[model samples]
Target: MGKTLSGKVVVVTGGSRGLGREMVLAFAAAGADVVIASRKIEACAALAAEVRDQTGQRALAAQCNVGDWAQCGALVEAAYEEFGRVDVLVNNAGMSLLYPSLDQVSEAMFDKVIATNLKGTFRLSALIGARMAAAGGGSIINISSVEAVQPEPMAVPYAAAKAAVESLTVGLARTYGPAVRVNTIRCGPFDTDIAKSWPPQVREFMAGHTVLGRIGDPGDIVGAALFLASEASAFCTGSTLAIDGGFQ
Candidate 1:
């Protein structure tokens, strides 16, 4: 069978590593031109080169801090300048630091989490989804976490922000429908770069909660992503597709 996502233009925030990088590689391999967006231009550029070399598909590296509203606009402008239109948008840039307690969660930390994980998704989806709606149709995929619903031992603020992301997906789907599709990938514990720092117990705890008896890997998400990004999910919108390995 032919690879999916042919002739598509996909923009992946946080594309420098982990799940984002995996998606970029997977999409390019499936014949899609990809835009790699991250706060670090060097990383994005490096990945862009790799994508081009590996898949021979056009790739653009654009520096963007999804936490900043203005930066989100710039990213969109840059994507359009290169690809003309974004057929798929993956809101994957996010951060959450563990603190001793919720009381210790500083205002700055809370705001940063909300801005990066929630506000940025809102702004990008609103702008991109509107344009996609106008230009016919496209897909907006938000990267959330299982913590959004099930409270994690740490990163409460982050979990809250992610919950809002899922809400944003449904809202955008309603607003931009008949053309644009907004969906959320409620991810579970994955062995991404950030997870490398997690203590052994925490890691084991997460893995044990899953029916699969393990967390996910970067490559595991590509299939669901490609489905949502391509025409295969034509009937889906305002959907929350969980890639949690059946978290308990």
Candidate 2:
């Protein structure tokens, strides 16, 4: 069989690092031209070069802070100008700042968390989803979190924002469906470059909660993303997929 995403154009925000980076490479490997966006243009450009060299897929790097609604529009415009159409949009950029305590969380920190996680998802989905709707159809994958439903201490604002992301997934699905599809991936802790900084004990504790008995490997998510991005999921929409290794 042919590659599932061959000839597709995929735009991935936060494409410079973590799971987003993995998905960018994964999609490119499946023969998709990729547009990678991050606040750091240099990092995105570096990844773009790597995608072109490794997969021979066209790659464009755009510096876009999705938190800024304007940047989201510009990013989409650039992608369309370069590729004519975007077949998939992965709303994957997010951040969680640690505060010493709930009481210590400042207005700025809370707002930043919400803006990055929630508002950014909204802008991207609305902008690209509308375009997808108008252009017949496309797939939109929102990277939510297990924290959205299972909120934890120290990242309250982030959890709240991701909770809103799940809501966005359903709403966008309804608004754009019949052609366009919208979905969410509720991610669990994963073993990525970011996890290298996590304390060893915390890693062990997280492992204890999963049926798989370990954190997700970076490539573990590629199958789920590809399924949703391709015709294999033609009947699925407005769904929140838990890519959390059956967390308990």
Candidate 3:
């Protein structure tokens, strides 16, 4: 983590909190200038200030709703305007809304899930990846979920979107290979703010079901994220790295 990403400019969507926030801080601490993008500008600005003060790295706080195509474009423009170039793009923004049942799921609900989890990733990756490739080389990291492979009844829309994201990762790698590296981190349940909504029994079940006998911490994602963002994963692309503590 010592200047591993020195002089690099990284943009992380949904970077104001949770796993995204962890990656933003890690990237900044590792010597990368970061652009923190999220719907919450206040949170983004607060984190950006923390990064600058603590890590001594340049940080730009941007308001971006990745679900919207126009906002995605503005985010890319903002990052480039602030940093001149982007060396890493992490498509980390995502959402999963609960519906009463499959039949009760409204079109808006389904669309929103797809837009945030899948469409945004595609748009951002396409925009930034092209620049990365043209600039010689760079890395694009897509944050996926275990739901992509193991679909649950309650989160079908989210699972479908994430599955598309996995496929999108491979397609993007092929599209921007030999220069721009594209990969996915398929994650399992983590003890983040989201877990606060879970009942004690649910949490217990989640912990017990994982091979590690515990849910992942927010920082658990930092290692894989750093590897993918830095030269440690130079030969990796179009790969899915599972950081799920062996969830089965």
Report the number of the highest-TM-score candidate: 3
Steric collisions counted per model: 0, 0, 0
Give lDDT tens digits, candidate 2, residues 1-36. 247899999999999988999999999998899999
RMSD after CA superposition, every candidate: 0.9, 1.0, 0.6
> How big is the positional error of residue 56 in model 3, measured in Å on the Cα after superposition?
0.6
Compared with the true structure, the alpha-carbon lDDT of candidate 1 equals: 0.92
Give stretches of model 2 more than 4 Å off: none
The sequence of per-residue lDDT tens digits that candidate 3 reaches over residues 1-248 is: 58899999999999999999999999999999999999999999999999999999999999999999999999999999999999999999999998899999999999999999999999999999999999999999999999999999989999999999999999999999999999999999998888989999999988887999999999999999999999999999999999998998
Better model by TM-score, 1 or 3?
3
What's the lDDT for all of these models?
A: 0.92, 0.92, 0.95
lDDT: which candidate is best? 3
Ranking by TM-score: 3, 1, 2
Listed in order, each prediction's TM-score against the native is 0.98, 0.98, 0.99
- Model 1: how far residue 217 lies from native, Å: 1.2
- lDDT (10s digit) by residue, model 1, range 1-248: 25688888999999999999999999999899999999999999999999988889999999999999999999999999998999999999999987999899899988998999999999999889989999999999999998899977687899989999998899999999989988899999999998899899989998999999998988999889989999999999999999999998
Q: Relative to the unseen true structure, what is the Cα RMSD of model 2?
A: 1.0
Which ranges in model 1 have alpha carbons more than 4 Å from their true place? none
